[model samples]
Target: MELEVYTYQFLRRRSRISSSRRRKSRSISPRRLKSRSPTPKRHKRRKSRDSMSLVSESSSASGGPKENKDDSEILKIEEENKKRRQQEAELKLIEEETAKRVEAAMRKKVDESLNAENIKLEIQKRLEEGRKKLLVEVDAQLEREKEAALIES
Candidate 1:
């Protein structure tokens, strides 16, 4: 009876899977698909510097190229900006040099502390600490052994 019920369920599932409800597994391949983007690239127009010239009628007005008021203002602003940048660079250099000097002094202090005499003193201190810890541990172990001996007796 159980076999018949299971076979009926299996047959129904197989029929459902084989019917229009079947899902086709797509197989992936190592190939690129055609993009065919909607918007095409636009053609850009380029101008050459060789064909450019000053529009002013007189070229000797300022002994140089004729620049408009806005251009002159921009040039002045650029000069001011350049000067400011130079000052900032100089300040940064001074700060860096000061930092380097401070760092060198700090490194020298560290080197001095790590000298042979200081290193020997540091090692002696660590050895003393280790000896103290060892003595405490040994005392604790001796106390434990003494307690065990008394209990055994």
Candidate 2:
């Protein structure tokens, strides 16, 4: 009985130690893990900015013209890219202005067509009214002539 109790207590203590270790590991932040890790690629990327000046200095020490040529080429390329961007922006603006002008012209044409249709309808209405007035006047004249002829006879 004594041996069995001691064995159970030992097992419980071992489990408790393992659980505490797991809690500690879970509580550790990512920053601590990154600091512990060896990331050579990240270090290389950070060193490249310093390396560019070293390369230029080495080229100058060697008395080479390549460095100046490379710099001029890079500047030329950057200028060309800037010019292309400006041209593209100008073209986009022109296209937008043209689209606006076309839209305005279309709207004006539609308005003019509508106005013309309205004028035509108004003219037709006036002609119809004039025809009715003319028929009434002719009927009154015929009636007056008939009464005059009857009185004379």
Candidate 3:
């Protein structure tokens, strides 16, 4: 009887599902799909220094090159720039090393001062304890002398 009931329930669920109720995934638009797709190669326009000049050098007021930079002058400028960069790098490295050494020395000094302070505190504690013991002994000695004097009287 239980098997019949289980089979009937399974068949009821199968019957409730219909083919017309099926759904399909959404489709992509052409423009968005094109943007996501791979692109083909195309020719590109290039701009040069001469083409970017405001005034034509060939018809200039001085009738000379718009830029006065020669090959040797450009080379000299590049060499000077390289030397400046190297000097700057060396100076920065020296500063960093000096700063590190100074920081380490400061830390060492601080640690040494802290250790000296701790030692001073320990000595002070020991001195206080010694004074307390000495006072106790002196009190006991005075009481013994008073008892002896009374007996002699």
User: What RMSD, rounded to one decimal, does every model reach?
Assistant: 34.0, 21.1, 29.8
Model 2 residue runs over 4 Å out of place are 1-64, 118-153
User: What's the lDDT for residue 55 in model 3?
Assistant: 40
Give model 3's TM-score versus the native structure.
0.34
Candidate 1: worst-modelled 10 consecutive residues by lDDT: 41-50
Whichever of 1 and 2 has more TM-score, that candidate is 1
User: For residue 53, what is the lDDT in candidate 1?
Assistant: 32
- lDDT by residue (1-153, candidate 3, tens digit) is 775565565446545768455332243332242333332321111234446354455435444353444544677999999999999999999999999999999999988886897877987999999999999999999999999999999
Pick by TM-score: 1 or 3, better one: 1
**lDDT on C-alpha atoms for all candidate structures:** 0.68, 0.75, 0.67
Report the C-alpha lDDT of model 2 over 1-153, residue by residue, as the tens digit.
Answer: 775565565556545886436322332333353334546875787688578667757677644467578777888999999999999999999999999999999999988886897877997999999999999999999999999999999
Winning model by TM-score = 1
- Per-candidate TM-scores read 0.44, 0.37, 0.34
Question: In model 1, which runs have C-alpha deviations exceeding 4 angstroms?
Answer: 1-67, 116-119, 145-153
